[model samples]
Target: MPFALYLLALAVFVMGTSEFMLAGLLPAIAADLEVTVGTAGLLTSAFAAGMVVGAPATAAFARRWPPRLTLVACLFVFAGCHVAGALTPAFPILLATRVVAALANAGFLAVALSTATALVPPGRKGRALAVVLSGTTIATVAGVPAGALLGTGLGWRATFWAVALLCVPAAFGISRRPAGADDGSAPDLADEVRQLGSPRLVLALLLAALVNGGTFAAFTFLAPVATGVAGLGEAWIAVVLVLFGAGSFLGVVIAGRLSDRRPGLVIGVGGPLLAAGWSALALTAAHPAVFLTLALTQGGLSFAVGSTLITRVLYAATGAPTMGGAYATAALNAGAAAGPALAAAVLATGAGVTAPVWVAVALTAAALAVKFAPWWTGSRRPDPIKRPRL
Candidate 1:
């Protein structure tokens, strides 16, 4: 893998921290901005919405620009948004900043995915992608916790300032292109749009959405399940989250090694096990040992399956390399947004915390069904080995 890939991962680490750290900062933000917690939560929703909308839009608009330029511009905009968010005294301005920041985040991620794959051999795209995405898994384990600690010790705005400063080095690193890092010919917008007409690409996107949706359905409610259902103490919440993050890191690494060569095998074994893990968690969450064990296993299975599906999207969208990452990003964000909302609905029905686990099971099962459907299974897929550069 090229060193530039690591720089992209570093950028992702900063952005991912900003993305996930809000969960811990909402209380402080609500009190400071004089808004209800529920209203403050809308910041997350705004970010997710921006990601879903901005991925393809930004990719299309920046199709003609050099990859490095697009990445650096997005990083600077993202950092600027954080600065604005930190200095803003009013809630509305902060909300607007979140939306803009998310747009930049989406753009950066899309281009980074393309660039990462471009930096590697055709056979190692999966590993390259894993290297880049591991940044997010790492952020979950370290960056988010550190951001929360910063928020607790200083203020919510301090976390924002920290994230902005973190972006500086990454942006500077990405601005300098290493040898062999080519600004490839810009992908034709028409060709990119045309790729969406492929049913395989469409189904791959749906699978990506379902896989992530199932994962988030359970993940978003983990705190309540750990404390109320699993009989774990409040302090153990962090332990379970850290355990899950560790498992996810392992899963992505394993997926990287296998997905390029045996995608079908990775998905085949992982898909059913992922659903079973969710089912087990839903049924046995009352047992602390079982809950904790399943937390790790399920996290691994979720990322392994999700990463494979995402790799499939890239393969299926070989005709639209520039836009392929945007499509995958949009689908994942759509799932991320939809999953928590559906899980919240289940909770609103007074279905108890564990009900979301069943939602996860159902979503995973649906994804499996989609993956194995006659149409998808029978369709001739793109050969990633023969695919062209982005």
Candidate 2:
């Protein structure tokens, strides 16, 4: 893999941290901004909504630009949003900044994936993408916790400042590095529409949504589940998140090695394992030790299945490579938004904190069914081996 790919990973890490750090700072934000916890949570929802809209929109608009230039511009905007967020004096302003920042984040990720995969050999796209996405897992391990700590010590605004400062280095690196052969062509709207029309591509995207939605539905409420259901303290929740992050990294590495050679097998096995992990979490949420163990395993399973899902999308949407990645990002973000909303509904109904676990199971099972659909198994839709460049 090219060194530029790792620089892309650093950019991803900055973006992911900005997104996930909100979970840790919600309480502080709620208190400082004098809003209800529920209202403060909308920051997360707003960011996800922006990402869903931004990916394809950004890809469509920046299609003519080089991928490196697109990525650098996105990072610059992303950093600027954080700086604005850090200086916001009111809740609404902060929320608006999140939306704008998320838009930049979505564009950066879509372009980064295209650039990273294009730098590698055809068979190694999975691993190359993995290298870029590992930044997210690493953020979960270091960034989220560090943000929470910074918020506690220096106020929540400090966390945003830190994210903004980090983006400087990421943007600088991306600007200086060559993005290989990826011209970062803006995707044609007509071509994307035609690509979306493919049943195989549609199914692949649905699978991505389901898996991500399932994983996040449960994960969105994990800290609460740890404290309320499992009887662990706040500190322990951090440790468990670190463990989950470790599991995610492990899954990405393993899936990277297998997705190229055995996309079908990877999904077939990973989908069920993810479902099983959720089922076990549902059954054992009251047991701290058991819940922690299952959370770790579940995190890994989610990403492993995710790696294969992206590979599937690239295979199915061969006609529109950049649009395929943007679509995948959009699908996953849609799931991310939906999962928590549905899980919140379950919570509102007094279904207990463990309800998210069952939500996860159902979503993952739905994904498993989609993966095994007749259309997916037919001879006419055989998985193709040839890959696209950025």
Candidate 3:
């Protein structure tokens, strides 16, 4: 791919890391802000909700701007949000900061992806996007863990500050890219909106929710799952998250490559592996090694299929890629927002942390049903999208 894609990918990494770092800092935020742990959790949800709404709202107006410049502007906004998030003293203020950050996150990913797609030949769009998006997958594996560790070892405030520092370099890198390397001239909004109205896009977005919900269910409560069900030492949860990240990073890389060749197969079957892993995790929590392996495998399988799904949406969107892309990000953020609460609800009822695994299996099976439904037929063709955070 071109140097442009890499730079956009790096900028995306910083944005993704900054947004998701809250997971690692939840406990600290609760204490610092004097809220319940559940309330701290809401912060993440609020941010995701912002993404879900902002993805389209931001993309709606971005059609007039060149893609690279749009991406750069978003990064600048992202950095500003992080700066506010790190320094804000009140919980409500932090929430506001996160909301702004989420909007920027949505814009950056959407633009970066739209640009990445244009940087390559039409036939190779999926593969090209995978390379740029690898940064996001890598963030899941590396950035989140490091942010968590920074909060644990140093302080939660330090964690946001560290991510903020990352944003500066990310914005600078993106700003230096060539002016029009990935800018396409097509007006994609109307076509993309029409595609979004299709059964395929709706089904795929639903699939994203279910798949992400399952992954989120198991992964979000990882700390408690390890301490309670698995009976593992608390010390190891951080290490396990990092290990899960490793699996996810590798999975994203492989999935991107696979999607370029066989997206339908990859997305159709991806949940099965994720379901199987989550099932194993719920059932074998007493077996520490098995539990960790299941977590790792789930990370790889669930995430690996994302680019394939995104590519399919993009291809289906035809002339309109931005809304198509924004829809995926919206779906993704909505799914992520749903995961923690869903899993927490299950665990709240004293079903143990495994309640979510059951939810995951059921949701995955439901997604499969829709994926193989009669109406979902007629589109074996590869598709495309615009930029939005995953």
Candidate 4:
């Protein structure tokens, strides 16, 4: 990919770290703000909720801004929110900061995905988007652990400050790019709205949501699954989590290569594989080795669906790439917000932590049905977003 793609990935890394690192800081934040751990956990939910609302709204609102400048503005706003988070005196203010920061993060991701795909040849757009999104996997592998370590040593505030510091370099890298003339043109809002009316596009968005919902429903309860079902020690949990992250990274690379040509194959087979992994976890939880192995496979197959789904949405909303990109983000975040709740509801019924795995299986089955629908298998709509061959 181009140097600019790497810069966009760096921005994604910075923002993704902000999103994932909050889990590790919850205890410290709760203690500092004199709130319960459950309340502190709402910060995570708040961020996801913000992204779900912000993605399409911000894309529509900033449709006329130059892409590079829009990205830079998002970075600065994200950094400012972190700074505010670090200095906030009360819990509500801190919660508000996370929501705003998530808005910036969502806006940046929508624009960055559109820009990255546009920078590449038409056939290479899936690979380009994979490169940009790899930052999230990398963050899971590296940044979140490092942020947790930093939070443990310094303070939660210090971790937020560190995230702010990381944003500076990404912003500078983006600012150096030359602005395009078409970047600031007023987008045809009417046309974009009409494009959103497509059933194919709406189904694609629902697929995105189902994919993430299945993955996260199982993931949110993983700690308990590890301890209660697998009988793993606390230290072993970290190792298992790392294994999952590595699997996710591998999944992205593999999917990037195969999706453009065999998107249908990937979605059709990958969904069932995901369901199977979760089902195996549910059935074989007593076998620690099997549970650990299944965890890695499940993580991989979950992320492996991303490239195909993104490409599908892009094709479905060919008239408005940015709007399509935003729709993807919104769907993913909506799933993120919903998954934990579904898992929690299961656990609330005294079904045990492993209940989530069953929930995951059911959700993945629904996604698989959607993927096999005739409309998705063959959309004859002409590509509206014309591209010059690179």
RMSD in Å for model 3: 3.5
**What TM-score would every model get versus the actual structure?**
0.96, 0.95, 0.91, 0.94
How many clashes (backbone N, Cα, C below 3 Å) per candidate?
Answer: 0, 3, 13, 0
The root-mean-square deviation over C-alpha atoms between each candidate and the true structure, in angstroms, is 2.1, 2.2, 3.5, 2.7
For 1-390, candidate 3 gives per-residue lDDT tens digits of 787777777777777677767776888899988999988887887788888888888878876677766777787787777778778889898888888888978977776666677667766777777777778767777888878878889889887777777777766776776745445465646666777677656776887777777777767777777888788897888777877777877777787777766775687677677667777787888889888887788778877775677776666554665566677777777777787677778778888667877777766777677777665565534334532211
| Candidate 2 per-residue lDDT over residues 208-290, each given as its tens digit | 89888988898888888899989999889898889888898888889888887787677877788889888888888899889
Clashes of 4: 0
Which whole-number lDDT from 0 to 100 does residue 286 have in model 4?
Answer: 83
The sequence of per-residue lDDT tens digits that candidate 1 reaches over residues 89-191 is 9999999999999999999999888778778887888999999999998988899889988999999999999999999999889887662435557667898
Report the C-alpha displacement of residue 32, candidate 2, in angstroms: 1.9
Assess candidate 2 and give its TM-score to the true structure.
0.95
- Best-to-worst TM-score order: 1, 2, 4, 3
Model 3: residues with Cα > 4 Å off, grouped in runs: 179-188, 378-390
Candidate 1 regions off by >4 Å? Answer: 179-184, 379-390
Q: What TM-score, to 2 decimals, does candidate 4 have?
A: 0.94
lDDT per model vs. reference: 0.89, 0.85, 0.74, 0.83
Find the candidate with the highest lDDT and give its number.
Answer: 1
Over 125-149, each residue of candidate 4 has an lDDT whose tens digit, in order, gives 7788788888888887888888888
